[model samples]
Target: MGLWLPNLEYLNLGSNQLVGSFPMSISNASRLRVLNMSHNYISGSIPDTLGNLRNLEMLNLEANNLTSSGMGFLSSLTNYPALELLSFGDNELISGELPGSLGNLSSTLQIFFAARCNIRGSIPDSVGELINLVSLDLSANNLSGDIPRSLEQLRYLEYFNVSFNRLDGKILDGWSFGNWKNIANLDFSGNNFSGAMPDRICDLNSGLRYLGLNDNQLEGALPLSLINCTDLVILNVAKNRLSDTFPHWLGALPKLRVLVLSSNRFHGSIQDSIATSFFTKLQMLDLSSNAFTGLLPTNFFHNLKALSEVVEYEYDNYRYSVNVTIRGLELPFTITVAIPVFTCIDLSNNGFHGEIPEAVGELSMLLALNLSHNSLTGPIPTSFGDLAALESLDLSFNKLSGSIPSQLTSLTFLEVLRFQNNNLVGHIPRGKQFETFENKSYAGNLDLCGFPLSKECSNGEGSETEKHDQVNGKGMAFIWKVVLMGYGSGLVFGISMAYVVFTTGRPWWLVRMIERDLKEKIRSWIPKKKRN
Candidate 1:
């Protein structure tokens, strides 16, 4: 707790288990330029005394239990003109409202993060004063009210996030982004936003790589102008009120990797993209719980080269993450493009009808596939056996017919297999992963008979209609005969007993038999301890 080093220019004690309140004595290090105490157990108010370091360039106190009544300490930071970054995220600051003077900090500040700090109230309009900010995060807070229009002043901003807030109102007009030429990432997800999305978001077409607007009240069609974001990698607009046809034009964005449009009002068929390169780099595609109809786009999957090939990706702060429906559950997963392994395609809970394309099997690196709750018909493509890395496959609640291809038994890594409620007939595939499936996996398919099902397959391997009917008839007849015999025997015994009771009128023979039986039962019921 002794800060005698007057010339200390750099201090980084991040990612440690240090505890206790802010060290006020640190102010003695007047020459300290970088002070980082992040990822520690620090608590209590951040003392304004830290601002005494006139040469301070960076101050990071993120991921601590720090609290403050009014965050007045931010005003003291203005004393240092060289400050470039300030991070105080993931702390219970209890700062009911950010001070308007927050915009008065050094103009050189390029990064500011106060996320999950129990911050409430509307964003102060003066925030626009920090025109040089490159990164700003205020996510997962109690922030509400409209975003101040003054934010448009941050022309040099590159990354911005205000997700998981209570902010409401229509999205800002396109002109708001006209000056944001350098904006690369912008996220407004998990908000109460409503109204049509502005097409002018493409104003930063050259540098915009990520745009997330999911879980909003947005309506109308996707802005076709988004096709201009040539550098866009991830575009998520799921769980909205949007109503539009599939924007085939989006496939033109060469770097687009993840596209999610689930739980929306999107309808109509996903037309074949004339561009052979459509979605070539795409790895995750989720279009479930929509009203899309017509055949599953064959050419679309044929062009999904990224799912079939081994392509490395650079790991950086831009790494994407999402909640995927795997085996009927929504699981969160971060996409590490560097791995070049896992891939998934979920089209469940849609109105799509038609045979699955054989081309899908070519995605040998695919890890999960979901086509459940659709009107799909025809046999499962045997090509599916080629998906060597597949772990979860769901094709249930469809009209699929014919035998399940035995080729599926080769999937050694398969853990979740669902094929229930289909027209599939014949013996279930045996060995390997198929044997691990329970009876529910083949339920509602009356014609399917095998080890898991109660209806055993005939030894002759009868799959034809005539043979199946014969087996069913014989089994039914045997059951009927046994039932009739039991009924007759019960009736005959009842009649004989009634006759004996009426004729004998409690005869001596009956009395003698009852007494002997009662004595034998009493002897057996005697306690073992007493007998001993």
Candidate 2:
């Protein structure tokens, strides 16, 4: 095994239990372009002689217990002209300033990853000189101070992450990040940066497909400029202090597939305009923990062809959620957006009201549907039985009423059925699918019965028809009680009037005249109405 090929251009000894410091003999391969020695128990300082490999392009020494001497060895790499990709992540090196000479590698450098290296102090402004850099990740470190304004010069950067750091400063404004239109991913989450997101963060990058800016102090409205990035597939701006009405600009993006805007201060009704036809390719949409409210458009799922495919099949636990504002109230309205073509949909913790759409049954390929913690009402749609592929269904903490549809028993593949805290009634079906669920699945229901609960049918037997009749009888009784109460009150009032007429000798005209005289006196004493 020691008889190695002298012409080896790449040597990968990563993730093995290789002990001891990097073998200085590795420098013998003068033509080696790639050297990966990551995720091992490798100790001791990197040999400074590594800089002798003038043709080396990539050098990775991550995930080891290297000391300050090891870091000093990396400083020697400042002389290597062809060194393009360098990684020194997840090491125990003490805090130190990056050498300014790192800027000298501007000619051919493409990637520089130094995450979790415990390096502190301000990021060197010289880093902006790496004009040829395409990917730069320095996350999970203690680097602080304003991100260098000079970073805007990196026109070729495609993937950049500076998250989990103490960087503070307004994100550079008007910088042409869009210049890197070919960039597909960018993450700056978990930082202390404060200020409105740069208005042009995505201005030039129409081809950008993913952007994450969560867990920051970003304020102001969502940048309307993002609409220009029509190719975005994932956009996460959650857990920030963003304040504005719902971002209407998002509806313009044709290729957007995932949108997460939760935990912000956005307030407004989920506009019907945005719900009508946009988001044709959206698969995961989370607008939770906001002040959006409104009746979700009935046809909200129509334009999403992927959703429609799920609804057309027989599946189970199909889930979909819509956050909205209704009548000045914040609410989350959720449904089994799970159709036969999708797996899950979550619309919990919003201000949605109204009946669950029966069209949800068309999601035959759905696996899980969560519509919990909302103001939704009406009966569980019997069409839900069409979802044969469903596994988990959560519809708890809503105002839903009526009996659990026996058709739900058709979901033979269901594993978790959650409908707690709803006003559901009637005997729970004790069939193949129903028998598998426990009391926890149907707990908060006052009128729910059957195999899971001790409450039997009205006839003290598990009779399906008897249970249905019992539910019907309760409904009838409720209606009659209301009607009878109104009728009885009317009868009482009529009897009292008759008694008054019989007992009083005064005519009706005399009573009316007295009342009119009093009203005229009162009106005369009052001031005249003012003009608007």
Best by TM-score: 1
TM-score per candidate, in order?
Answer: 0.82, 0.74
User: Candidate 1: RMSD over Cα atoms?
Assistant: 24.3
Q: For candidate 1, lDDT tens digit of each residue in 417-520? A: 78899999887877777767799878888888987888988855554634543432222111101001110000001111221222334322212212333444
Q: List the residue pairs that clash in candidate 1.
A: none
Candidate 1: regions farther than 4 A off: 103-106, 174-176, 312-317, 324-327, 336-342, 451-455, 462-532
Q: Candidate 2 lDDT (Cα, whole model)? A: 0.64
C-alpha lDDT of all candidate models, in order: 0.73, 0.64
Model 2 residue-pair collision total: 48
